[model samples]
Structures are given as structure tokens and as C-alpha cells.
Target: MRKLVMVSMLIGLGVLPACTRTTNTMGYIVDEVLVAEVKPGIDNRASVEKALGKPSIAGQWDDKTWYYVSRNTKQTAFLMPKPTEQSIIAVSFDAKGNVASVNRRGLEQVANVDPVNDKTPTLGRETGVLEDLFGNIGRFGSAGSAGGPPQ
Candidate 1:
């Protein structure tokens, strides 16, 4: 009985780790006070960078906008991570390099996208396995033909 109880306790201890959830923070770590201090017109690229650090991503089309993204996710063993909190701060700069606008967004902007089927549908003639193997057999050429052995 004592041996059985010891084995059970060992098994329980091993399984405890798998039952616990893991939390992960991805992208820039946001500091609310610093973010709040960044003011439009007063703060410029250099000040913003000093306060908030470098941005997570810059504007794709132009260098006028900077984005700071943060996300917190919780995941279980062998399971996909689920976002619990998300924040995005977009700072737009004017031609003079001063901050033009500062915008903050939350989890409401997050979108769930589902991909299509695994096999991508392509534009072409569909052939069977046998057709693929023997398709080129006869097409090679016959005697005296361009592709055939010379007579």
C-alpha cells in the first residue's frame, strides 16, 4: 500500500506541469506611462524612440508611421496559444519629423483568419496516377520521327 501511494504521488507530480498554463509576451513590452508621455507636435522621432524604444514595425508604404505592437498569450501543453491581451500604438510623423498623431488600439482590432483547404486548387488539366506514368510513353516518337531513333 505504501509503495502504491508513493508511485501515485510521483505520477501526480509529473502530470502537474502539463496541467499548468504558460503565459507568453510577444513584441514590444508596453509601458503605459512612457506611452502616455509621447505627445503629438511636441515629441518627435528621437524623443519617441528614447521613451518607447524602437518600434515593432515601421510603415510599409512610407517611413512616416511607426507601430508598437504587444500581445499576451496563454497556452496549454501541446495546444495553440490564445491571445488574452493585445495593444497597438501607431505614431504618425509629419514632414518636419515631429509627431503628427498618436493612436492606441486594443484587442477589438484583432481578426481571426481561417486558411483554405490544404490542397491548393491550381489551373491545369487533372490527370490520374496511371495517366501521369504512361502519358509520355507513346508521345516520345516513332521510327523516322523527329524524336525517334534515326533509320
Candidate 2:
């Protein structure tokens, strides 16, 4: 019986390592060699696109900037994924279609934003709950009954 328990324990120990999964990756996989070929001020949009392909995200309002984003996450078993590595390459262009700058950002630049729940103040007369509930009671009338139109 002791030998049986020892064998079962050994089997369980062997399976424990398999339970943890390998790192998972998502988004664009940046190649340093390809990125290096893009020279600031000299490389234009066409050349950059040819070298690095289309960007993951472009500037929200315009095409003046492009971003290549990549992230690597790891999770063991049922735990939430934690980002182990992240890369964001930002490329900006001038209005004339020439490369203006090339910059890189990491995970440290991520921001956590929490939205406020306060109602927006508007220019109107404020009314209490009872006034609001009964305010429109006598205001609504059928246009047909008022001789405006026929249905």
C-alpha cells in the first residue's frame, strides 16, 4: 500500500508541470531587421509600408501617424493573462508624406482610465421627482383631437 501511494504521488508530480501552459502571444510580431530598414526623414510612407507592412493602428483622426502594437501574455491554468512583454512602434509622417519620426514605447506607457458617473449639467429648469413625473401629464394631446390632422 505504501508503494502504491508513492507511485501515485510521483505520477501526480509529473503531471503538475504539464498543467501550466506556455506563453501566448497576440497582435503584430515585430521584426527588428525590418524595422531597422526604415530610416527617419529618408523613408517615405510607401517604403515603410513595403518594409513593415500595414500598421496595426493608424492615427484616429488622420493618416499622419501609424502604430505597430504587439503584446506577449502568459497565464498559468485558469488565471487571467498577464502581459509579459509589449512593444509599440510609433511612426509619424509630415503632411507631405515624408517620415517625420520613429519612436518606440513599452508597457510602462499604458494608462488605466476610470470614467466618472456624474450627470452632465445642462441649461434647463430643474424639477423635482414628483414634478417630473406629473409635468407631462396634461401636456400630451392627440394632434387629430386638436383638429391638426386625420389618421
Residue runs of model 2 more than 4 Å from their true location after superposition:
1-18, 111-151
Tell me the TM-score of each prediction against the true structure.
0.71, 0.66
**lDDT tens readout by residue for model 1, 65-140:** 9999999999998898889999999999999999999999989988887768866778999989999888888777
Best by the lDDT measure: 1
Alpha carbon deviation, residue 132, candidate 1 (Å): 14
lDDT of 2 at 90: 92
Model 2 clash pairs are none
Q: Candidate 2 vs. truth: CA RMSD?
A: 6.8
